[model samples]
Target: MTTDQWVIPFYQKQFKWLRDAEAEMANYLQIEANNIEEQIGIEFNSMLDIGAGIGSIARALDARGIAMTTLELVPDLVEAARRRSPKSIDIHLGDFYTYTFPKQFDVVSYFDGFGIGTDEDQLNLLKRMKSWVKDDGSLLIDIYHPNYWRTIAAGQKMKIDDAERIYSFDEEHCRMIDSWWHNEHPEEIVTQSLRCYTVDEASSMCEKAGLTITGIFPGGAMDFDNWTYKETAPLSGCLSYRIKLTKTI
Candidate 1:
């Protein structure tokens, strides 16, 4: 099965924890937001959070006094986001590629949710987002780094309470695979799925979409302690990038 086929249903069920998970993810994004805001030094008047799943990222921005609009393709997720932040702004339910924006936004972002689409879908989505961003507006994104799969393959696992999920395998091959289970969740329950993309290939696609890469944060948002990327913890497959991109002239 393709990434989208699995991810869409996975998220639909996973979002059942919207009440709790959204807040957790929001806290992490806030930390990222502060760092980027300091680097950019401009108050974003409005934000377009693509694939804003359950409004976690948008809620984070909203809490910071920034107005945000969420765009989600999943019907259930969109309704959930809209309900979660009813007083905030719009929650458009459709593929962002098909959705129309009333005006340009100061910031446009896709928080890992865009990874569901195929490479061509991803490229088209990026190019579409670039058109909605105002001149010099920033785009923040998060995706697992392709290089870290090797280290992850060496065997990585974390225990939560009485359960544990582990990932182990080589990533050098184009067909890389990784899997994990929620320690506390049921065995039949869905867990993490496999996804792959080289950094060079992803960067090239971003460039083609008319955005320049600025910073690449190197840590996944697994927990509070291991959020930031450091030189010491360089070989991590489960990583997140706080890429800063801007619309091309």
Candidate 2:
């Protein structure tokens, strides 16, 4: 019943992304580790970064002696990340939902990839993450806030010549449609859809997965408005928030 055109050539081309986002990754690593240690009174011995785009965070953590693993569904991205990571950091090319790990991690993370499915699916991911963490481990996830997302004008489309890509948002479903094509073979194009979610909705999903909110990181550099992690800290007008969670048990 869906008439929207979706393509399949995205994988043919290399996407514009980071091989090593050193500065940003380091900043996030230090801030998050500090927050986790200060609040939870412990440091993460091991970590699993779901949807680890370029292995930036994994490499960063690896440099600090933390055991790291990067999981990505895209083969191309996974290969890129693997080549860019150190030997100590393990990189796997597979879907996080179904991929099996050798052992549980002390911390599980999903940056900018939380809202890729329906409410039930998102909850399912959280549940999966729960099983992948140690009894006292943590879950760090960056989530899309509804307010700023609603401000994005839907149906507006754009094309990038250099990237050879087209993009648009289907606001009704909170999905962004992305397509890529080769300049020589424009006839063959590929596309992907990404779904976004809000704070309350993601929190409810976390509860369903037997996780509890421990802290919220609001970074302006990361599109989160300046905010202190308080019970009454307002998240309005914020594009995203890094939510920290812990297993219920």
Alpha-carbon TM-score of each model against the true structure: 0.75, 0.74
Alpha carbon lDDT at 62, candidate 2 = 80
| CA lDDT scores, all candidates in order | 0.65, 0.67
Q: Report the lDDT tens digits of candidate 2 across residue range 10-83.
A: 43254542133456457766765555455444766788888887787677668778888888877677777877
Candidate with the greatest lDDT versus the true structure: 2
Check candidate 2 and list the clashing pairs. 7-190, 7-191, 8-190, 9-189, 9-190
Report lDDT (Cα) of residue 238, candidate 2.
58
How many clashes in candidate 2? 5
- Candidate 2, TM-score vs. the true structure? 0.74
Candidate 2 lDDT at 219 equals: 38
Per residue, candidate 1 scores C-alpha lDDT tens digits across 114-200 of 455466777887888888888878888766565565443436655434345455544444323434344456574544443455567
lDDT of 1 at 243: 66
